[model samples]
Target: MKDSTQGTSPGPGTPLPDSILIVGGGVFGLSTALALAARHSGKITLVESSPTIPNPHGSSIDTSRIVRADYAKAAYATLAESALEKWRNTDWGREGRYTQSGLVLVSSGDQFGKDYVRESYENVKAINPDAVEALPTRRDVERAAPGYGSGLHVSGGYVNWGSGWADAEASVAFARKKVEETGRVNFRTGDVKRVISEDTGSAAAAARRKVTGVELADNTIITADLVILATGAWTGRLVDLRGRAEATGQALAYIRISDEEQAKLANMPTVLNLSTGMFIIPPRNNLLKIARHAYGYRNPQRVPSPADSGSNPTQTRETTIEVSLPEKDVPIPQEGEDACRVALKEMLPAFADRPFVKTRVCWYTDTPKGDFIITHHPQYNGLFLATGGSGHGFKFLPVLGDKVVDAIQGRLVPELQKLWAWPESPPAAAPPPPSSSSPDTVVWTEDGSRSGPKGMILMDELAKGGWKRSSSKL
Candidate 1:
């Protein structure tokens, strides 16, 4: 087999058409494009109007985050295991674990969360028996890390040798680097106002109805055979998001713990306080990250309808971008911050005297069941959906990427069968792209083909320069 890290090669048949298009540059979108490019060399193009990884509106970025395989289901567990192996063994850049800080999940004795924790522990142990241990009581939490409050501990806890925190930004950049090396994936700066699907009938239709290309606000049509929308917060409006968008919203809080306070939580595993809906991630560079995993209630219908984006240019159109609305701008409540502070102090009194050093808001695209909705849209034949991650989706991204790639390739990923499925009936036709979407820019093609290594370098320069002009507002 060809080296997976190397750029893709033209497959059998009329040298697989040289063009493939991707809509979002967030980690998922970029990673998918990278994976495909590494496997099949083609003219790959990724459109992202966001200046960087977090996409001012992106949900992928965080100061520090955890990655582990503690899941109630086998598929999710397996996916996480894959990601863990990749991060640990691959030089995807920055190492993704805190060797010293253990990861912990706590729930009340009678709560439903106990099952989740217990299942997660048992599942992880099944994969690597020698490395996992269970701590059944709050007393165990205190005993494992003295001075820790019994209040924070609960019915169960588990420590696994392989799981821990990683620098989110670095991990993303590392993946981005791989995308660039493939030479096929090119990152371009432009807001997509239209996704044009050619109307072709038959297996030959794959070649005919392939994405004719996208129309930007500038009105230039960039053509491609396949399109993937990975735009984070803006995805719902840009595409037919189904029910996932309605449940998504932004969250924020400031962690006031100090080095001294962290010392108390140090060597401590990442804490999931189910009772409070709060998680106190271990401190990174002297700061603690705290937030709740409560249900989100943002208006998903706010995203502009694509029909409106593709229709009459002279007409005025409204987009359901709630985060930017003045009314929705009412800040994430201070009470949320206060609650986090008090919880930290309650669990580790050492934090009682310190104040938060920094704070910012982020989003969680949620689903009603509190689990992820990784389904496919019925309207768009080749389009695949991977939203509705809810709050705890980050740790599973690498594995999730694999599932997404499988879906994109039209494979039946069993692990995703439960969490992801296409709707039974045909989806109503999507509205044309809204007029407010970005106007198209002139499409640029590679002057010539180069070996994988040379193509990879060229692609990186294009993405860096192409995406530099993107907005911070996303």
Candidate 2:
């Protein structure tokens, strides 16, 4: 996690564009802005559609998100370990923003969760063997957290005391404040309509054409030599990520617990059952949160083909393409609610039937392998993509931006470069269900971390509630 530009002059490479514009202001956008302003003296402008930095509708605005270096892949595990050190010792995690509540990653059946957790355990064990304890059975899990209700589904897992959860909204706000304090980045609020571009040569040249700027929803134009799309779930709408990324809505629900109940479960570590993709974080302020990390619901919409959106009319005909985009302020579908209920029944039986105080469908910019797309666009020149959090990017906020800046400057370590590069031939997206015509571009994250059914439509599932569901925990 060394700052690549901290010591030396700019390396020999194409000079960075004098003016840089960033779209979207979630973890990726703000963090990238923070790093750029810190290391570069160029003009940096960050444009977010929302009036504020932490858009309430954004996925990163949740109450809590797991912050751990226990990743199945050695690369992410290594990178997350560096980020963890910052969270533990730096001001980035000050003021109640981070809590070392510990994490219990478990799995019951012979699904991918078993292998994933095993791989993750070995990885974390390497980082800090002293902080990681292996749980060999359901009883071991119970002993670690006596507060859990009986009949837990965990067969085996591990507890990493060094891991914790981050106050997502607070951390994001901290990033914004830091970026503002730099007094280097200019902030703007605008709804970007499309990337402003023109055909430089023949029709074939459209793929390599450079975007001079972006056009806003209000017909306002913000010109820049470079445009970085940090847009999260909405990224598919702005770029032709036909097979690279899509938006998936994960379910999250909160229950209000009495002071007594909160006290009873005070310091219990977060429990995650990868076999079922359900997780329950200990209560804070008498509020308990239950969520899933599965192949979430989709809300696909048709939009003008991004490749041709701002190109010459004659060079390319205006055509529509379907991309899974975020549907905001939406309630969890009945399917998701049922899953949450099951998870509650197993984790905290006392509150199994309690009504949820609030529920939300958190959106993620998912990639096929659950990798973040942090490299330059393969077809579009002068454009870079920093989206594709794939449900795990928030933990890297402390150092992710510096890594992104490194990538932009052509000096990122070789390992991350390979992980974030555009797929040469991305796997064909899983086809839509027979009954529906989902966006052919919809890519359900097939990373071993995901569980539950795939290709579920949000509206369709909402309309068909009360269906039979697995009575086990979420």
Candidate 3:
């Protein structure tokens, strides 16, 4: 792999072609579109399957997402640090969109020897010593945030005052507005069927193909000089990622905090249990968002539509029924609810009995090592990919678009180039076959014992060991 610092290969240069089409208007697509519109004098068109820019099912679309630079890896830590700078300086940071409440990391053991929390603390400290502060014991953690060390055994950890949270959905909307004002970028709402390609000759026939543009579900064929697949989670449905990525749906729950509890926990920072991959966002609008950062459940039944079927390949249709809307029919599964409950009970017991105002099965396009893929297609010319958020991409919202632009221009730094490059071959363990039942008909389950919306138990019903019907709103 070539070093990205050497800059993109000598070719068309940073100036993009006149017509550029981006499929999937999530974080990756919008950010890249905005960057391109600012840099290149061209008409950039973005196709979003959903009705709006921030597709409600997109990993980028959410109420609140953590923004922290305490990464176990130095490269990501550096990127996050740069992203934080932009978050604080840009409009996205101001206007009450970003909250710098700091971040707390809790570990089950000492701050050394293979502990993720310790590694993160050490890495962040390496960048800026003052940015990280050690909490030597559970008492130290509780002292920093009252009742934070209640049920959990917090041996030691650290707090990065530089970290905080962002309103993800709002941030995306703001970016969309900025790009729209430029007039160079046009937002088109429709499901992309597939990348329209053409065979040039015998040389291009055997191996290489040129992507001309994309065809929509309505059979509207829009041509372009370049086509970028920024479809998060649904990338596999559009292109063969060679087992590099797969969509895994993780669980997220919003617990309604009482006025008293909200006031008491108002100052609490975003808390992360590095060992368990569980984290809690600060209270906002009387709701506390709790989620996990693990390899979540694969939707075994929701298979991607065949590319030749003339159907939307972005999985937008399935997502709309499964998650895009606030419909009460979407089930979060008992396992998801229990996972949040267990983590919260151990970390913040006071809020364990709070009612779950809402629950969601957020999806992520996961990679094996959690590194993002931001390279061009090996077999198809004029085709590029910017997917693979791997659950942690939201935090890098401020600067991720520029990186994608760098990737498109082949100007990625050496470290990032090697990290984001496509693998020569697929992994040893083959990815599961892309076959599943219909997303609408499939039943969500927890350990395969019980299923349906009822399995997503309410907090008040947890003690009774039975389902308790409740409204799905605060």
> Whose lDDT is greatest here?
2
Ranking by TM-score: 2, 3, 1
Candidate 1 lDDT over residue span 90-111, tens digit each: 6642464323355666676675
Model 1 ranges off by over 4 Å = 1-18, 93-100, 198-211, 244-247, 250-252, 256-266, 297-303, 307-331, 369-376, 425-474
Query: Against the true structure, candidate 3 has what lDDT?
Result: 0.70
Candidate 3: segments with Cα more than 4 A from true spot: 1-15, 110-114, 147-149, 301-329, 430-474
Q: Return the lDDT, model 1, position 124.
A: 83
Q: Which ten residues in a row have the lowest lDDT in candidate 2?
A: 1-10
Worst window of 10 by summed lDDT in candidate 1: 442-451
lDDT of 3 by residue, 1-474 (tens): 111233344455455677889888888888888888777787789989989777776777778888988777677888888788888888879877798888888776732222666778887887778777899887888776674656766676888988999999899898888889888887888988767877656654546667799889899998998888888877766675535666666678998877987887767888877656678888877888888766465543233443322122223343411321112224466767888898889878877877788988677777766778898877777888888787778878767877788777766776887888876665554233245322332222111111122212223233244533353331
The TM-score of candidate 3 is 0.83
lDDT on C-alpha atoms for all candidate structures: 0.55, 0.84, 0.70
Clashing pairs in 3: 4-412, 8-410, 301-436, 301-437
Misplaced by over 4 Å in model 2 are: 1-14, 201-207, 309-315, 431-436, 465-474
For residues 236-328, what per-residue lDDT tens digits would candidate 2 score against the true structure?
777777778888999999999999999887688989999999999877888899999999988777888876532233346567888888887
